[model samples]
Target: MTWTAPEPTRVGEPLTGPERPMLQGWLDWHRRTLLTKCAGLTADQLKLAAVEPSNLTLLGLVRHMTDVERVWFRWRAAGDHTVGSPYNSADNPDGDFDDVATADAEADLARFEAACADADRAAATLDLDHEFATARGRRSLRWVYLHMIEEYARHNGHADLLRERIDGVTGA
Candidate 1:
């Protein structure tokens, strides 16, 4: 039997909380928003491209975001150089989005969830002020949270369109 992506359990973003909790909550909400967009779609549907000349698909977005989480949190923020991105490389820079047609949607979704979990774990011990070097110079854990939130927000919008395109389902 083919694996199926499960519906995400989305929680309301905490309107009142500490700096860390609020950031984490908002990030989690956005993450779930992405998964929720993909939920209830079949593997073939998940792989359907938005239109001609565009490789953007729900599965591709999931795969791309999984690597984004791993890269920022596990690698850069936590300073773990050994942990490499699951998708993308020098030869296949667009693997995350370009290589989704034959990809396993369920496995990719699980990978996204696992990456998020690992990101949370990697960030748990760090202070918001903790800094890490990147190609754009040094940045802080606080910046990582804000950046991830922004990244997800942008992609979630694309996901919303992709989901609606796939089936007439709409609404957040």
Candidate 2:
């Protein structure tokens, strides 16, 4: 079946489940929370390239997270965590950082939403205890979940500063 990408998320709290997750679910929650920080800005705002050749921006982070989602669950996981994608070639793949020029605010938000949806599905469907081979070799699905959460959280911090610099907003 063809998977049309998810639309950009609404600007608000994440749509949560009735009972909260133990660990994996919590990781998923944090990832969504991080993305919410960039929720309402325009593509030009989201793609605001840093001064003096720095490649950092909210749009770059969105693409990188999509790469991370694909890397961890789609490409790296084993057993219950079956990974997949909506796109075939990531093209230069390095475009995650270098291609910010192509970022349409709506498009970037759509990419982030799609990644979040796939990640939510994987976290729900996977066996947390399942082992996956990584560059670190034999990492459990739980580790991947937590690592991605941490990764997203760290990027969100960077995003917080970037967003503030783009406008005048502040606070986490």
Tens digits of lDDT, candidate 1, 1-172: 6555688899998999799999999999999999999888889989999755777999999999999999999899999989876778999999999998788888889899999999999999899999988887999999999999999999999999998888977777
Give lDDT: candidate 1, residue 120.
98
Give the TM-score comparing model 2 with the true structure, all chains together: 0.74
Number of backbone collisions per candidate, in order? 0, 2
Tell me the lDDT of candidate 2. 0.65
Instruction: Report how far residue 103 has shifted in candidate 2, in Å.
Output: 2.2
Stretches of model 1 off by over 4 angstroms after superposition: 1-3
Q: Which ten residues in a row have the lowest lDDT in candidate 2?
A: 2-11
lDDT per model vs. reference: 0.91, 0.65
